[model samples]
Target: MKKIILGSLFLCASTAYADRVDNVQTEGVLSSQITMTVADITCHINQGLGISQQIHIPTISTNDLRTGNTKSVEVPLMVDCQASNDQPGSIAIHLVPAGVSTVSGDHTITTSLDSVGLELAWKDTSLPALIIGNTEFTPAQATNNVWDLSLIARPVLLAGKNVTEGNYNASLAIKVTYY
Candidate 1:
């Protein structure tokens, strides 16, 4: 019967499985511990990036002055980080440029002012500057596993363009990760 043929096939297959492993040898003792530890990473921000910031620009009348206009904005990225063994760990940050999320390798936002170019550069104020978006980089953990982060942003107009008179805006995202 068809039923008998199927049962014979199943029996043969199970017998073959045992024969396949006949030459296996027992290895040395294998052991490990699934240890658990506690770590604390905290971030504090009084205001989110959604809030529109009103920046005061003196004036934009002179062509020479407007072409060389540079503004600096200092912000705080207050954070507390603690890794295993109570030591500083490797950390990386990815800042999503204004008006982008799904795209990869995003950079600074394009200024709203017509026929004008704008660029932004940001870095940590510490001795060794950690310029965001420059290259693939990770920084050693701050002392005491805590960081009072002070970030500076420099927004400047790209050369060789006639400056325009208007207020421009941009928004960016900050993402921090540790390893």
Candidate 2:
């Protein structure tokens, strides 16, 4: 009789337990677009200036460098600003020289010719000549916002230095400011 009562009590306890359940739901959305824009000034290669060019230098003996020498080549600076901004906006131009010189108001021109010190200058037809690391704001010609400025690359030798015979090359960075 005690066993029967114990079995009945165990069955009742098992039935007294309860069950639990849980659930979750979620939703997400992402919709966006991106756009990029530039300033109202553009550098273009309509002719010869916008591209790399080689200027021939006058041959000189080692002693000639003591007095300094100059070599120059003519090129055109073409730019398209017709639709660059609202109306015919103005622009500013400057040049940064590529060299290893640390002298104030002086820049270097990296070239294959070793032991030779050289300087570069930009001669605009409408403005005074600007050396490397200089800025200027003068337009040579503009028609409907198409700028056609004339430029000359003038390289001069540093005094009291000797230059070996070889070809030298350097690229100038042109910075344009628009208003």
Candidate 3:
């Protein structure tokens, strides 16, 4: 019988793969971290939405503040720096006055009509009196990075009292720093 039917069909395919079986399971693990920084210099004031710039003192007549005659307005300070290789260092300017602090000490800065106050000079009169919160160090008439400041806002009569006609305002804040 053909060699006993091929030895019983190879013994039923080796007992059907020796009754098969296999199973596995195992999992977990992952991570991360990074940091960076780079800066040589950068500055932007009066042109960075810091209220841009505005000053307009004209109509004054408490007999022109009793014959002292005052009226000055021109507060323009534009600083734009970006140094890396051009090397623009040394620039510190800060004049913050949102009112109050007037007896004319820190160069006045208080107005809403209370004997009127607003005197912050530096029209090249040896550049030095712009102190309201103090942080002066301005001497950059023409650097490649730019820093042009020619400010003067006068309308002082603080403490002379009794010169109120109503409606007078003052508010200033400009701070720039670079090393």
Candidate 4:
């Protein structure tokens, strides 16, 4: 009788352990993926100079009028990204002008204006981050899932009466990253 009782107890313990192991093995695997896409990316400039000759903007048309410049021209840039299973995604835009130092990177514009005594300035007075919308995917904390971003750059030309007339050119680069 004693031997039978001991055998029964061992059998019950083994069955319980097997059931626990089986439950763990049946648990599903957890996994995720992330992806980003730029739905539409474009840029344009607006000039504020009053004199046509002083307003020879390059991003748009050569024939653009410079008369009655109200505010410096506004350049608009758009970017879009999407993620499948990722948490955060971010993008950085770099604008570099010809003859400017690449070391400065995205901090400043290096292109030289032909017009003498003409002052050029960026509209980002507050130096605020160019965020797409209020949707959150900012340069700091990028939003999860799909994000749409739009940014505008304003260029103001402070030209004197004796400003020179010529064509100015610059280049910009846009980069995106995900984690």
Candidate 5:
């Protein structure tokens, strides 16, 4: 009887150990893919200037619109670029409206105020007016991989539309591509 009891206890212990082993998970796989962008040049907005820039346009009067004179503010944008080698990379920048476009017939971008819009151009007038979302302005390198791109913004009234007086706001995005 003693021998039989001892043998049964051993059998029960073996069964419990087998069940524990079966419940254990033994295998798994983890995977990840890495991708890199290869470019000869990289450009960034100057740290001090930051990515967002605000141009303050002084108040405009209806009489001012009747005449050709309007207040224009200078927007100075500084960009820093680095080339992988001695050869400088080509950089092109374009402006895009951040929100819905209200482009008027005169090629001016409409602001929040009705009939009121803005016109953008390079400070160096020889470069020509910057057509919103259409023209890419190529900036000359003022120094070693540094660009002092200056632009001008002015408020104008559309023809036949009455101006609404209130605060007006508009946003523009500067997109840069390097090759």
Candidate 6:
């Protein structure tokens, strides 16, 4: 009988200990997402023109001691930065004749730009003239992205008793760069 009581007590203690034992549990959940997009770049020429009158020197004679005449030709070139990513910091433009990639003439000419207000002359004997200008996008500085540059090419007809009678044909080209 004593053994039976001891066994019963031991069993009760074991059962109590088992009940006190706790079942621990842990869990975690993680999630994430990502996305992206891209686009292509492009450029185009909006408008360009020569803002000077086409001169017609009918006849030049030897007795005429006066020098050649000068005409102001304004080459107005416009570029639309609306299509560009941002406003261009600066721009450079070069003018070349249609057939000739370089300037070759008899007389020296002076040219400049009114926007940036810069002037330069041709030092070389082969080239006719060199012109430069500065432009800004601001309304106060420059109204539009467009730059209107003026160049002066003085045509000095050779002084002699008998000069040729024919049409003197010449061409001009303008190149632009944006940064």
Maximum-lDDT candidate:
5
Worst 10 residues of 1 by lDDT: 100-109
What value does the lDDT take at residue 153 in candidate 1?
Answer: 48
The full ranking of all candidates by lDDT, starting with the best, is 5, 3, 2, 1, 6, 4
Which residue pairs does candidate 2 place in steric collision? none
> Which digits, one per residue and each the tens of the lDDT, describe model 3 over residues 16-80?
65656333233556566667435565556556655355566788888776566887777777666
Residue runs of model 2 more than 4 Å from their true location after superposition = 1-70, 83-88, 99-118, 126-134, 138-144
How well is each residue in 31-150 modelled by candidate 4, as lDDT tens digits? 889796654432221222211122244342222224433233444333323323333434444333333312122333323443211122323343433222122334443333333332
- How many residue pairs clash (N, CA or C atoms closer than 3 angstroms) in each of the candidate models, in the order given? 0, 0, 0, 16, 0, 2
**lDDT of every model, 2 decimals:** 0.48, 0.53, 0.65, 0.37, 0.67, 0.39
Model 5, 40-98: lDDT tens digits are 55455664565587778998777786574798888777667644343234556677666
Output the number of the TM-score-best candidate. 5
Tens digits of per-residue lDDT for model 2, 37-148: 5544544554425545544656655555544545556655666655444433455666655454322234445444554544544444434435444454444446666765
Q: Give all TM-scores, in the order shown.
A: 0.49, 0.49, 0.30, 0.34, 0.63, 0.39
Error of 2 at 79 (Å): 1.4
Higher lDDT: candidate 3 or 4? 3
Give stretches of model 5 more than 4 Å off: 1-40, 82-88, 105-107, 132-141
Model 6 Cα lDDT, one tens digit per residue, 1-179: 87999999999999877855566334667677767434332334534233233533334342331333333233334454445555555555555444322233322221221111111232212233442223222322223544333344443433332333333445455566655
Relative to the true structure, candidate 2 reaches a TM of 0.49
Ten-residue region with minimum lDDT total, candidate 6: 110-119
Model 4 lDDT, full chain set: 0.37
What are the candidates' C-alpha RMSDs? 12.6, 22.3, 25.5, 19.8, 19.1, 29.0
Which residue pairs in model 3 clash with each other?
none
lDDT of 4 at 150: 29
